[model samples]
Target: MHNDVEEILFSKEDISRKVKELGEKISKDYNRDDEVVVVGVLKGANVFMADLIREIDIPVYIDFMAVSSYGYSTESSGIVRILKDLDLEIEGKHVLIIEDIIDTGLTLKYLTDNLKSRNIKSLKICTLLDKPKRRKCDLNIDYIGFEIPDKFIVGYGIDYGEKYRNLPYVASLKEETYK
Candidate 1:
């Protein structure tokens, strides 16, 4: 699996430090009284979400949302479909959307819109990776671990052909692996 990587973008240490910093900021911004819910986008964000939540000092409810915009293709299909929904109601709660990466942002936009309709008290986005070069819609990420160039990255729960998720670092995939 390591052989398929072209370059390492964020190492385990780097991600750990950043996630800790983000957690501290989140702790400071929201009080324990605030009904905080951390909603992780499934599969890709599993690792990041796990690490991030531990760093957060305040108690937070956790949930998972499985939306698909990509199947076997490397790029998004531009259509967001919900494969799984939240088990708990988020109305009047401070909701934070946890994502592994934000590329085209279309799928997230669709999700944000859907979540907004639920009448949550607040909504924010926290992503481990942001590809501003690939953004196709206006979006604001409240917390960002790294701003990366447009590339095919997989690791730390992100996958290619459902492989490479166990790699300890985030890395760009080799061209030949996908080509």
Candidate 2:
């Protein structure tokens, strides 16, 4: 895996610090609310979701939503479908959408819209990485850890062909290996 990595972008410490910061801000923003619900996009956001939830010292709830936007590819299909939906109703609840990365913006957009239609009191996105270079939809990400270039990164719960998500840190994959 080291041989295939071109560069180590985000070390484990760096990510941990950022996640803590983001959690602090989120806790502040939702302090007045009765129920603060965090909905994490599945698989990739799984690790971040766990870490972020622990950082918040306030009372909060967590849920998962699995979205299928891309399948072992960098390009998005411009369609969003739910592989797994949230079990709890977020109607009239403060909702935070946690994601691993925001690339095309399609998935997040779709997610926000769906949540909005459900009468959630508020909806905002929090992503670890913001890849504006590849965004296809008009985007706004509330909490962002890093603004990264257009690179296929795997680790910290991100993946390629369902591989590399368990790496301790974030690393850019070599093009030759995937192409």
State which candidate has the highest TM-score. 1
Q: What is candidate 2's CA lDDT for residue 83?
A: 97
**Could you give candidate 2's per-residue lDDT for residues 29-133 as a string of tens digits?**
776546878899998999889899998888878899999888877678887889999988888888998999999899998988888899877788899999999
What total of clashing residue pairs does each candidate reach? Answer: 0, 0
TM-score of each: 0.98, 0.96
Clashing pairs in 2: none
TM-score of 1: 0.98
Q: For candidate 2, give the lDDT.
A: 0.88
lDDT (Cα, 0-100) at 145 in candidate 1: 89
lDDT of all predictions, in order shown? 0.93, 0.88
Candidate topping lDDT: 1
Tell me the deviation in Å of residue 26 in model 1.
0.9
Per-residue lDDT for 1-179 in model 1, tens only? 38888999989999899999999999999988999999999988999999999999998999999998887889889999999999989999999999999999998999999999999999999999999999999997899989999889999999888888899899998899999
Model 1 CA deviation exceeding 4 Å by range: none
Pick out the ten consecutive residues of candidate 1 with the lowest summed lDDT: 1-10
State the local distance difference test value for candidate 1.
0.93
